[model samples]
Target: MTTFDDRENAFENKFARDEEFQFKVTARRNKLVGLWAAEKMGLTPEEADAYAKSVVQADFEEAGDEDVIRKLLGDITSAGVETDDAAIRAALDAKLVEARRQFIEEA
Candidate 1:
């Protein structure tokens, strides 16, 4: 293949890898955040695991993190937890950092 074609292919591969990496990181973050919320809601260990999976699934509902945030907000409130959007957003940010750290450690 021509040099230009090879460079294009390399870029495409890099883009795909980056997208996959981001997806994994976001999913991990969602799971972590879900567990955190579950603890706040006073869920049992088994229930927390299922709730975390549900939080990851919630992300697939929309293009952004709003879906997960909405689910957490609704559930936490329904469970009688006093929380706000800012708190949830902060948890997301913190868990994202933790997720990235876990990935780095694994690597």
Candidate 2:
């Protein structure tokens, strides 16, 4: 193969790996936010775990984080938790940082 072809292949592989890493990080962040919301809603430990998984799955409903945030806001408010969109967004941002740190540590 030509040198150009080899470099192209390497770039493609790096892009794929980076995308996969980002997906994992986002899912981990979703789970962390889910656990945080569950605690705010006073869920049991088992329920919290399940809720976290559900939050991770919620991401599939849309392209961005809006779907997960909507679900959490609805559920939290329905459970009588006093919170707002800004608060949830803040938590999501914080959880994302934490999630990235956790993944980096694992790597």
Candidate 3:
């Protein structure tokens, strides 16, 4: 039987070995993180999608999550989003969890 941990570790090993998959995972997860970030800051869906694009772009630029986050906050600041990082990150984590739930249900 394939245990969850075994599957996760296999993926981890594959990630370390496969540049293409690494890029794909980075792009996908960063976009998801960006969507989470945007909703956390209460952006409209359009703005959130824009933020997700930005996050993916940032990842393409080889920036870390913190840099992507900093960029996101900067954009939100320029756009006048009011929530602080703690609130936004927390809301994002919650939203991400909910989104995953919805996605799994849909699947």
TM-score against native, each model: 0.98, 0.98, 0.51
In terms of lDDT, the best-performing candidate is 1
Q: Summarize candidate 1's per-residue lDDT along 1-107 as a digit string, tens digits.
A: 69999999999999999999999999999999999999999999999999999999999999999999999999999999999999999999999999999998999
**Candidate order, TM-score descending:** 2, 1, 3
Q: Once superposed on the true structure, which residue ranges of model 2 sit more than 4 Å away at CA?
A: none
| Runs in model 1 lying further than 4 Å from the true structure | none
Root-mean-square deviation per candidate? 0.8, 0.7, 6.8
Cα TM-score of candidate 2: 0.98
What are the clashing pairs of model 2? Answer: none
Candidate 2: global Cα-lDDT? 0.98
Question: Model 2: per-residue lDDT, tens digit, 27-79?
Answer: 99999999999999999999999999999999999899999999999999999
Off by over 4 Å in 3: 1-17, 76-107
Note the Cα lDDT for every prediction shown.
Answer: 0.99, 0.98, 0.68
